[model samples]
Target: MRILKTRQYELVEAKDIPDPFPPYAILSHMWLSPKEEITYQDFKSRKEDIENDVYKQTGWAKLKRYCDRAARDGWDWAWMDTCCIDKTNPADTQEAINAMFRWYQNASICYAYLGDVDAYGSLEEAGLIDQDHPMNEDLDEMPGMIPVPGAATNHMRTAVGRSLVNAKWFTRGWTLQELLAPRYLVFMDKSWHRIGTRESWAAEINEASRIEPKHLTTFKPTDFTSCSIAMRMSWASSRYTTVEEDETYSLLGLFGISLPLIYGEGRWRAFDRLQRELIMVYTDDSIFAWKLSETNQGFIRLQRQGQKPGLGILAPSIREFRDASQIQSFGYYGHKFEMSNLGLKTNARRWKCHNDHTKLLIRLNCGPEPKAHTGIMLRYAGEVFERIMDSELHDTRNFERSRDWIGVQEKEGKDIIIRAGNFRGPLTGPSIFTLRHPDEITVGLKYFMDFNVPLMSRKLELLDEVSLLGRLQLQRNELLLQPNQLMFANIELQTGEHQSRWNVLININENGFPSVGMASQEDRGKQLGDPMSEAKRKYENLAEDFHDQAQSEGCLPLIVETKQGISVNVHLFPRPPRERSSETTRDGEVYIEMREYTLKIIGKEKKDLNGSKQPQSSS
Candidate 1:
């Protein structure tokens, strides 16, 4: 690393300096035009030119003041981006980008020169200030000096607050790390006058940037993990960089990630590289917790004719994470994610949307509440799943408070692929999905078959099949069933005392074929098929290789292609029979067959259907 020999204002490599590397002060500021700002080559070729210009009336004064301040603080070295490193050298650029955060952190003090703001002059002419004494006009005061007496500076603070809020330094992409990494920072105005220390003006800085004051006041390099990826990105949403690539490059240090500098890759490509880097090292699901801002909702509206969903699984920019705060990521046991050109392959449960069967929310392991979760919305498009950028997912209801929280004795989540819709590039579009599990049939389970009843034999239609599918979906979020694993729909029937309750169960039948059936319920609460533990030895030996009828995986979906471009699956299981009947031999009357059995009913979706009913997936 090369930094300036402060007193001489000459660049010196750290290896050229004495034994242990000396401490340095760093300068952070907004850059002027390329021609106006000095560069490293310029410093090497004409050392006296910098000194001559510094002594003259020019923009070089900022450089001079920065050096003078560091020298005053007993530091022989200072580093500024403008001239410390050769930007023309890719190696230097890479080193600088990677080490920026640490350099600021290691600095004993950071001088944040806000060339567009002031100390206390604007209000001095106004009656708001005490006219008894005028404040100093320049930053010649020593470190820690206050414009007004510390005890009597409310008006002075207000002036400083107004300036800090409007400072361009707060809006630059690079200055974000500068504000948080340094142990101590002093803000200087256009005239090089002190505005306030980072400690004193943290609130104003936070108010300006919408970042929490704690991030500014108490920060450690490792604190990045404490904040959600979305929260950290939120800090940069309103900030911008000169070169589009810098928008993502400037943020590399904050994430503890490194990548080769790609100056011409454009903003999207740079950001894409950054996200892919994070996915390699971080397991937090909050990385997927971004939504389209209201301003950019039309990002997908201009789709060309015949366009199938274009939004990728990853957002196009940090600006889209405007509202993602207060969300945290937690590990859901057995969860894993693998990234590929096909997109992110992960084993995570999903929730079929309540209002739209075609839309599903892949439950992220992060949420605003402890017991609940929010997911990225994806609309099923026949063969693939398209990501939804609609504002509804980000509104006040926390994704879907109306949805029930099911206690699932979850196994490893079904293996699924979240597809990046277009592999050409991120700027082109977003993503969709495909499932690696054998049965990724789109969400719905309707029609009950019973040969005993003629009309019902063909099919028993429910009042609302779509709603039932939604309710059924939660019980088995992912339709991927391991051999014999079943899917169940809990329906607590609301019929009167004599009401016969029925449940929809999909399980592998006696002959190892998928079967759907509705049977009378004997009791309340959701019931699933248990392995038939009573098959006799004769039955077990009947077909040596055959799966025993009693030990089938209950409710496993059986997807069959009912029509071109449309496939359907069904599931239901049997409940042991219980009959209420009586037979008496009356001498003069008829003899009814001896009484057998009866079943009492209870269902979860029975009442839900009483009001409204309807019906409505695979990889």
Candidate 2:
């Protein structure tokens, strides 16, 4: 480290100064244009020549004034970042970057210079008249000094306050640590006039930057770790650096961690590596709770296209940390966590979304009580990971008001596979659902297979007769349905004392799979000619019109069932298939076999006489 002799305005190495280091004040200011600011080589080559006219140039004049003030305060040495660290030497540059926070913390005092503010004029503009005012005529005043009357209010809305709040000093990444690390910080305007101290202007600073008051007024290195990771990152979110990578490098000292300086590795990669290192020691899940602003919703859409996986899992840039203030209210328990292939895995129970079978919810324990708060498990890279949706779980009703959850059951040795459809939420796109346990993490479709009387017999007979091709797979306690396959869902409905069973055939499309529904037995032919034939004809005509409109709009008409259990007339319209050469494509068009079946009732039992229903067949 290099220290400057205040009186001589010459730099001296700390080792050569004396046995004990001198108490020195540090200058904290924004860097000026390269041509105006003095560099290490420029100072070394023309030390005497530069010092002679240093007071004439604005940049150099501020340095001289800082040293003069430090000397007046009974300090022999002062440190200024501009010419103190040799930028030409990589080792010196890296060392200075890593040790900057500690240097500010250890300084006797810090002088924060705001070159844009005019202290005296701003005070007068704010109605705090100078000593020359009639009200202060009776009071004695020093020359070139502006004194405010004892009755004047502390209103800093004038030009000085605006300049102080909007100063370049507040926008730099390095200035953040400079402002917080110092024990005593004094704000001075352009003419070297005092504006206020850190304590006096802390509220203004907090309002301007959204930083907590405790951090600006009374900050310690330990406070960095004590605060949530997202909150810490928020401080630097709006700040920028000349070199992009320095944004992350500037924050190393705040977290008390260091990494080798790699300048060319863009800002995103630098911050990504920093976050990876942070998670190694930090145990807060809020670090992964970055919110996407309206501008970055494109990234979310891209995630749906499978063009970008894991991009939504982590924040794209540091600017997103602006939302970190909201995450602090979550009051999350500091649970130790590890990164799973899907997402983050912790010791938390998982539940499936009842409204949308594709969505999964993980119960996060916020406090000592087992009352768990829910967070959605988003899919990225074929794995389901958990992220806090709402900060405060005081009323889980905020999210639970629309959705529902079912407890997941894992077979003794087999992993639980939860097959859900595409997520229909606005924020999270289509995501796979998975449940993670202490011993293992499972990802796949697992459904409770409580087969009805007839379906159980069919499953046993099919197991012996036919090979389950890309259609279905039988597990110990669950069944997996493949895509583009039709399956029967049996549901039992009860109205008063009378019970009726209905069976519906559904086909899982290629877009979203892992579908589940319930069905049961029903005799449609017997209820066709009931007393409500006129109403039934009207309903059938509406269904036909809807089917015609769906074909015209190029959308598939969703199947709708009526409670009357009536067998409407069947109709079939065949569209000619276009022929194409196999050489035009590597994988030929998928030929889905169309099988038409008629439901036949025999002795109170209903069964398919032929095969499964097809899209072309209608009843």
Candidate 3:
């Protein structure tokens, strides 16, 4: 039976230990951890003392004990810088350094305990740290300054200056030729020790196996060779190496790993890096191993169980991985950020427009903002108003409208009349429009009628003719309502020498409706008129039925069914901020200065014609 020695756990005077151990004890146990907590600030402040204590108090025996247990637990391979060889003792350090290649050749695995295990795991999960690659890839790679790996080797060797074998000491024995040996490079987080709970490591190990079974392993005595199972264990370092060697080795082995290889010029592509990383998942035919280079900067490689180890490759950056994912949830550092739903960027903007009285048309420049979609709002203001006038305002206030099949049958020789059907009145004229602001009224008429109009209607025809006027002639809806075209009509009335002419064109204002269009009411009597009352009435009835059914069934009403309830209002009576000031700006500027608006349709219970119903709030 193997005699496993246990240390005598006894509290001793700080002065009983060596010079560095005394101070180290004071800093690590006394100042840093005084019964309650360990403050990083205090630890950093006493870093020197901490280092001294680490060097003095940490002996080879402790490391050797851990190594023996680790081996017994079926961890055939181990790589603790302190226990792997002697460092403080120069002769032993050199001897271990020379035999590193051979040591790894014989060992089945290598485990690196980076002080902060949870942090290491997080960095790896986030793709911030890397391992299993040479520390430095190129000297001329960094543009402004020399590129250096974030962490150094046990010998304090800079990543750039260290030879390939020494730089990749963590993965030294892994060669393409020695493919038969099942080698693993494991990273044990040091943070696990400082953590108060015991379940962290166990949870991590279990979760890795559960979620990523291919990446994790648990040790058991029965499992060996191609089917060997092993659980990593702790041991003392003294048996593995001398006191002086363990002391010096501990310091050099403290850092993580990195790679600096450049695959392409400019920037690396995400897909390419992903493909590379995926390929590296397979090591040998029977076995495979993976390691994080540094915290998150290394690449992974897999070889056949009996293959010779190849040179280490650099790990791709996180940015590259995200790009490679091609998923909508993958966001970049700048420009487009990923949204939660589809990985696509949510930077896309939307603007909607509607006219309370008639058809709203808008024109925009094609320069800076690319033109994506164009829409016209044929509102139901007239029908809504009718409902209000009939004392049925409550019924229509929270009404939902649906899309009605619209047709524009042209009446030959008849001019497109703006005030048609229910909207005709004595005072109002056929609303004409022009892209330009009216300097003088050329054509005019009298009559104003309020009624709902179809999206494609005589109203739009009249608007097209009015806007084209003397400059351009338009015959069909397709010709006049092109994307990004503006429409407004010129109304002129001459009274002696001083002429009075105002443009009373269809409110083809901006990207949205004017506030008045969405306002509940101008006064008690006045209400917004709908354009397509017949269609709107039908749609509203259907929507009401659907809404009623949804309410009964406990379901939310689909907003799409609530057609023209969405309307844009442009208040002409209340002077706008731009118009309030007598400043002559560009026509585009004036349109932009006008208050834009929209209506959020709301749903309510269907009103019974005979039932006593509560008054509905106007919105």
lDDT of model 1, residue 490: 34
Q: Is candidate 2 or candidate 3 better by lDDT?
A: 2
lDDT of 2 at 590: 16
Every candidate's lDDT: 0.58, 0.53, 0.24
Candidate 1 segments exceeding 4 Å error: 51-57, 128-153, 221-225, 304-306, 331-334, 353-357, 382-384, 392-413, 421-619
Q: Kindly list the per-residue Cα lDDT of model 3 for residues 68-173, writing each as its tens digit.
A: 5355445433333332233345555555443433443344444333332343333334454466534322212222112234533312112212221121222212
Candidate 1 lDDT trough over 10 residues, lowest sum: 428-437
Candidate 2, poorest ten consecutive residues by summed lDDT: 581-590
**Candidate with maximal lDDT:** 1
**Residue-level lDDT tens digits of model 1 in 208-277:** 9877777776655434346767777878878888887888888887787788997878677778788888
lDDT of 2 by residue, 1-619 (tens): 9989998888887678876787898998888887778777877887777657643455677778888878877889889988899988999999998899999999989988877766666657766666575432211132223334454543543345566777778888888888888888988777676667776666668766777677776565544334666777788887888777888898987777777888878676777777767656655555654555443444344343333333334555676676665344234454445544434445544565677665555443332123334353643234443232222223233345544666656432122222221122212112111111111111122112112222323121111112322223322322223322333323333334544544333333333323322222233454322213333443233223333343344322222233533121111222242232211111011123222222211111112224332222211
Instruction: Give the TM-scores of the predictions, in the order they appear.
Output: 0.62, 0.58, 0.17
Number of the candidate with higher TM-score, 1 or 2 = 1
Model 2 stretches astray by more than 4 angstroms: 54-57, 130-153, 156-160, 224-226, 310-312, 329-334, 340-344, 348-350, 362-377, 380-403, 407-619
Give the candidate order by descending TM-score: 1, 2, 3
List candidate 3 stretches off by more than 4 Å: 1-204, 209-269, 272-619
Best candidate (score: TM-score): 1
